[model samples]
Target: MAAGAPRIFVSHLSGVAVFDPAGDQVGRVRDLVVMLRVAQRPPRLLGLVVELATRRRIFLPMTRVTAIQSGQVITTGVLNVRRFEQRPTERLVFGELLDRRVVLTETGEEVTVLDLSVHQLPARREWEIDRVFVRKGRKGSAFRRAKGEALTVEWTAVSGFSLEEQGQGAENLLATFEQLRPADLANVLHHLSPKRRAEVAAALDDDRLADVLEELPEDDQIEILGKLKEERAADVLEAMDPDDAADLLGELPTDEQERLLSLMQPGDAADMRRLMSYEDRTAGGLMTTEPIVLRPDATVADALARVRNPDLSPALAAQVYVCRPPDETPTGKYLGTVHFQRLLREPPPSLVSSIVDSDLQPLDPDADLPAIAGFFATYDMVAAPVVDEAGSLLGAVTVDDVLDHMLPEDWRETEFHLAEEEVATDGS
Candidate 1:
């Protein structure tokens, strides 16, 4: 490439808007396909995975790209609608390379692969990896310490780790997916063939698997669950939120569901049964039984500690249910709820009951979806407590779960596709 030629980082390439020669928007760049070569040689650019408005992904070979500029890629309009498939020799820049471990050729030190710069080769139209931007310490250590500096070195100075070379049964590939968000990991799993999806799922731990499974569509959820051993599947189900586990079990055959439920611990099995008894569109079906709860007399300090748990979803952690004794679900009596904001504003020594929102009415377990939706809209609450007729605290319905049921059946899949387009448009 000419010295003056502008180079683009692979990270920035992702979500760039692709336009036809006539300036009509085609799709957004999701990933770049590349072919690895001998040591010290840059990988060859193969094509672009363009996600269309219809949520269909297609391949756009490099030859079809007329020009590559900041925030946008110009293509020849002539495109192949066939779905992009990875060949034996190809690797995805965003999916496989970013945040991966690569060895520095000179010191043999392993650094986290941060980003890659690609440019057209000198005197030729072919684009190849030009430079690699990497961080020196263990993954995520840089962020925890400070905004550590990055080392920009020639691609040849670092050795790339390829999953294919490590073999099909390699567990190392799981490490790559660990860096991705559950939704993004679900997208990667959705694109893989059933066999590959199972392999990847098997490599993940129960918690991670449960998280990714929750993000997947019902069909994908059923398929992946079907792939696991009965015992392991039960464990993953147990690791999932009670409401989500119930939702998945509801999709399976009665016999299959029974077998899986039987394998789970009795307490978990009972929780699943209780959730399963409710209609799918009701508050009882959508609420998670694991909301943070405390006795009304508990200190604000206790409420803050519970909210500090990293595992709690933002919506679930936004408020704490103040119940009577027997604080576990079917908590003795639903007293009221204390918003997280109140906990922060009041002194730590203050009793939770003093700050509780007793005026906020709790929803009945049998409340319909419309009632649940209106409750959230009217109260402007991220979560609300669910109660039995006797006013015993059962669980809490989060806005996320409510929206999950309110949206269309294929909403997750549709939203994922639309999000990419929105990013593309916003970047443009």
Candidate 2:
């Protein structure tokens, strides 16, 4: 159970029969279900689907198994009859496993795995359990625990399996999706093409896809939007940031944009239109409309109270933002930001001005790409504050937005070479 350990091939896994310690025969293994495709390490077996004599299928986790005997597999955990309960037709396959917490024994890392992918191998015309990706914990958490461990274990290393023995395991996975790492998820989305992006969007229910879409890049955003029907696209847009919604609509053809906008709720459409009018690089354009705002005179204690509120936006809750009273120009009178970590370390009754940044540089609304890039590199900031000529805070530009404009010249060339090699192998 190390990083990049080679697992025994599925060809070597045939005829592994299953039985109980009481010597009651259960079923034989049919095939493996690998969730990941391209992994840094070996795959994880989700479980074995035993073909029962009654024409029913029993899902058994490899961890429940005690030994792989020549003719029968011995198990320690009793197969619960309740687990065989059929879900209603409305539920998705593996719906209960998403966002669940799992003790990844191999890496000793704990995280909620947001989703599971199944991989089908073409060579053996067989399926194998694949990789498991970890979700990152919340921002500004004191512990900063990793969502998943880096090490990958073969399906065989699973020593045991059971829910809390109090509840079902499937239920646990669904509750932890929000704890997943947005960046890792962004990378997973990055590897997919427009076609596959469309397929994935189609397969996922709108609510689940909406959650995942917010973590993806603008390019991927455009691709997913393009593929979805007008109503479906509108639903996702409704859940996204106003700025994100605008950016996605702007990328579409003008007629289609109007059509999509028409399909959206009136309130959502209006907000998107407002954000769309500004240049994408501007603070007014990129800043989320949903930032947590407080009067300049609010005490740090009051701010802390607000931060702890679950209703506050995750971004602003992690890093508190202070602003002057809403005037004719909101951006011209904007104040500085303080990390939530900083607030926790200091006295609670401190005034907002004491923690506010006095000399923070504000971004120009119309600053070109190089200037924006220079600002990020200059400040070494994960997010840079944006402002107009009046010295008001408009919005913030994130490192991810900068990355959209900075692709390497040889990126496609490298991909082309890989594609050519694939073609050659197939021809041979």
lDDT of each: 0.84, 0.56
Instruction: For candidate 2, report its TM-score.
Output: 0.48
lDDT by residue for model 2 (1-428), tens: 11233434343344566678788777666544323212123233445556666656665544355555355667754452212323211122234444455555665645555443334343222234554444545322446644423333433332222223243232233222223444444444456666655655564434446656766655666777777767668866776666666777787889988898887777667767767878766555665555555667877888787676543345446665677866223433777776677788778778876888757766776776678788878876656666667766555666655664466534433544565678789999
Best by lDDT: 1
The per-prediction tally of clashing pairs is: 1, 17
Point out where model 2 deviates above 4 Å. 1-89, 92-199, 203-207, 214-223, 265-267, 280-286, 305-318, 326-332, 390-392, 408-428
lDDT for each residue of candidate 1 in 1-428, tens digit (9 for 90 to 100): 23358888888888999999899999999999876654356776767899998888987877568678768999867665645656444578899888888899999988888899898865555678889999887678554752455799998788855333344552445544545889898987887888889888876656678999999999999999999988779878987889999999999999999999888887788999999999988999998988998997899999998887556899999999998989779889888999998889999999999888888889999999999999999989999999998989999999999989988999988977887788789999
Looking at model 2, residue 162 earns an lDDT score of 26
Off by over 4 Å in 1: 1-172, 416-428
